[model samples]
Target: MEPHAARPLEGRLALVTGAGQGVGRGIASCLAAAGATVAVNDLAPTRADAVAAEIRDAGGDAFGLAFDVTDADAAQTAVGDLEIDILVNNAGVPPGGGRPNRFAQMPPEDWQLQIDLNLAALMRLAQLVIPGQAERGWGRIIQISSGASSRGLAIGVAAYGAAKAGGEALIRHLGVEYGPEGITANSLALGLMEGVGRAGDPAVDRLIRGVPIGRLGRPQEVGEACVWLASEAGGLVNAQVIHLNGGTVFGR
Candidate 1:
């Protein structure tokens, strides 16, 4: 990576949940590129270690922290005593369309799972990381959200939309409460990103067609936003959900 003026995050330690693959992997790499030592956290040890190794091989500093974010005990253990300056709460698992059936057909278990993975775990991390940020008088936390939080989403995904929206609101609440302490929290609202999970599904093509950019969003673009938000250069950026949906909201 070429040198730039805003090395605001150099020497900072960043812990990114869900750093196993896709957008999470991209964000971890972006933070590392900015000279931060990244803790690549993920539920899958193999994916987490692989991403961490990639960062190290690229001449960046990184280590893997493997655990399920939804597990409170595991979260405390994996993030035990971290005086981290940045946190990217990006771990999430899609319902895989099984729960996207009509509301009447949707299973209660699937809805609960979505809520647990996307919303519950994020709030837990905020609780875990805030005290340290408050003590430091300077820190950043960037939550990864979905564009569906504000706009319409896929069929039967009402629960996911609601949960993501709630998480964004939490980011705003923390941003306001901690701003005086020099800690800023923000969120990135994303749309259809290519090359990951159901993102490449044919059904998603219909969603992509609505994007003015005429293509799916890239993981790197979303990662860059997280990197900026976690850096000191973004000191004034707090409590905002910057949509990276490539104009897909034109119809919304």
Candidate 2:
């Protein structure tokens, strides 16, 4: 990326959920490196603090915010205290894809759990952040979606796909409703990537086979993309879901 496009995040505050590990941590670090004051949030209380410490050690302004995003009111209120200009909803658990009873014995509750975490809560959080963004007249909300959202998904992940698609729709709607308020909302439809839960499983092979790039993606790569979209360079870009699936699905 060009130097100017990267520097727009200077002094901005970015709050990332599930930031204790994986893609969330990567996004937080990258935003901090790009000059945003990152607020690293996660369900693991200690881990969030640890990452925040590391960021501070690197001379980046950051702090830990540990809370379950499913608690809609609490999550919103906690983030409301921060001076966040960017929001990254990266929290969710991975469905083993194909699982229990060879998919024949899947429980109704199990399926609903995935949707609640992956999709429903995201919609709530976006709504939570809107008031702050609109008041400021500038904000960036970036969500981490999934490649599973494209396929029927592995046996156990039908619900995951549904949730992710819901998230994508929510993001697009937010873009339309809030872009005029100077708040840009977008999603990074992630490809298979190392470090993500379940990425190492052989079941991922089917997902990878279709990739033109023929490789796993990295959290830093997604992080860099977030930096771009959050920058002024991406001002005109809104409501677009950028699928970072290494040519798996182009221009979705």
Candidate 3:
């Protein structure tokens, strides 16, 4: 038996949204390490550039892209010309920045923002890339969803959870629609992560205790899952939601 080799994603081009930091950045780095050329995208230009530079410094191929996923025109302009083999929809806003309200009390604008960015943005980006992918006969779409999408632990993020649920459904439909074209659509429902820059917070202790693993998931773990799904190893897998929550919630 021979030792397994890395670089399974060699010759692939990946575009990861909200990759300036957190899980997105980790996924970009992991894909790059696996020999994929990555486009590190974020709403802030500087953040995106920094991440891309970090990847380059680590001896990987990557570039920065700053664009709002919610902006259809900007998304089209940013991605229209690229031949992306993998798309990771990781951009989204968490609820409750002095705006924590119950579903009934939440403002309409807040709901719209969540839906537009979380659900609609994924659909729009998929539309833009699906054609090229279909033409080439290979593509991977990975949605970075949340545990709230399947559970009712949304609390103040009712809208966000709702949108994520919708996104999951859309991913399923896309899988069924495009599986014949060599495209796979799936989602990753992440729980409280250690690499979201929120490690060591006392507030997260309870959440960590709740996990079956008794710890928060690392960003690199999520990245590894993304790489596996994007690689040839996961070609037959589609329309599935892989929950990366360390057994925080199950039975979906």
Q: Which lDDT values do the candidates have, in the order given? A: 0.82, 0.79, 0.87
Instruction: Give candidate 3's TM-score.
Output: 0.93
- Tell me the lDDT of model 2 at 23: 78
Model 2 Cα displacement at 102 (Å)?
6.6
TM-score of each: 0.91, 0.87, 0.93
Candidate 2 regions with alpha-carbon error over 4 angstroms: 1-6, 94-104, 196-210, 249-252
Cα-based lDDT at residue 103, candidate 1 = 55
Collision pairs in model 3: none
Which is the winner by TM-score between candidate 1 and candidate 3?
3
Best by lDDT: 3
Q: In model 1, where do residues sit more than 4 Å from their true spots?
A: 1-6, 94-98, 196-205, 250-252
**What is the alpha-carbon lDDT of model 3 when measured against the actual structure?**
0.87
Tens-digit lDDT track of model 1 for 13-92:
89998888988999999989888889999877999999999999998999999998888999998786887889898876
TM-score of 2: 0.87
Q: What are the per-residue Cα lDDT tens digits for candidate 3 across 1-252?
A: 111357888888899999988888999999999889999999889999999999999999999999999999999999999998899999876422325469988999888998998999999999999999999998999999998898885467778888999999999999999999999999999987774336576766766778899887878998999999998888888999989987778311
Question: lDDT tens string, model 2, 50-130?
Answer: 999988898888899888887777787787666568989888774243332334566877777777788877877776777
Model 2 worst lDDT run, 10 consecutive residues? 94-103
Quality of model 2 by C-alpha lDDT = 0.79
